[model samples]
Target: MIRKANISEIDQILAITKACGERMKEDGIFQWNETYPNAEAFQKDIERGELYVYISEDIVLGCIVISTIMDEEYKSVKWLTPNSNNYYIHRLAVHPKHQGKGIARKMMDFAEELAVQKNFVSVRLDTFSKNIRNQKFYKARGYKQLENIYFPNQSEFPFYCYELPLKK
Candidate 1:
């Protein structure tokens, strides 16, 4: 089941992110590390009621943040969809041990459904340029790749922005 994340789940959420980071590093992907997606970020996300977690058998398998707020950096991109009334996706993470079980896909499905219900024009997100798997995943879901954005603290490489238009 997917539901809003509680503050108490922060520890499990952090663990999932940590495991995911370790797994990515093992595969030579430096998308996440000790800095980005830290506890503070998740805490703020929870406080804002934007963070959602995927649970199974009482375990927090994954998490995703869907919000109407976009970062200032997004304003610089020439997006395919209009800026207003859009949903921005962030911190999409699935535990390595529970991966390949379609948890991430389900979370995305939930997010998109919520977007449609909220009359959002599109769903916007970013993927690490070096993470080919993630890039392909979003592209396959019809997310159009736009220009790149940078998170200097996370990696030297730029992150690619993507948008999936919900309205014609």
Candidate 2:
């Protein structure tokens, strides 16, 4: 089941982030390297009410961060429509052991439901260029790709933005 992340789940979230970083490195995914998604960032996200975790049988299996809108850093991107309340999803991580079990999809479904409940018009997210599987996955789920955007911290790597309209 997916639920709001509490302070106690921070360590597990960090472990999952580290595992994901390691796996991505081994697999040549270029978004997260040695310095991204650290514990401090996760702590900030949790404190800001943007973190959510997927749990199963009392074990955390995945986590994601959602926001009503992105920071000013992403304002240049044209993917996300300028609306008062559009949901933004970030840091979507699934435990390596529990992958391939449709957990991420379920989490996404929950996100959309939340957006609908909140009366948001759409949902937006981004994926690393090297993460081909993610691009395809999001595409299959009705998320259309926008222009590639560069991260100031990692200018060498670019990310593909995606958006999905939630209006029925």
**Best candidate (score: TM-score):** 1
Query: Which residues of candidate 1, in runs, are more than 4 Å off?
Result: none
Clashes of 2: 0
Q: For each candidate in the order shown, give its overall lDDT on alpha carbons.
A: 0.94, 0.85
Give one digit per residue, the lDDT tens place, for model 1 in 59-150.
Answer: 99999999889998788999987779999999999999989989999999999999998888999999999999999999999999999999
Q: Write the per-residue lDDT of candidate 2 for residues 124-160, one digit (tens) a residue.
A: 9889988998999999999989877887675477888
What lDDT is reached at residue 145 by model 1?
96
For every model shown, the clashing-pair count is 0, 0
Error of 1 at 92 (Å): 0.5
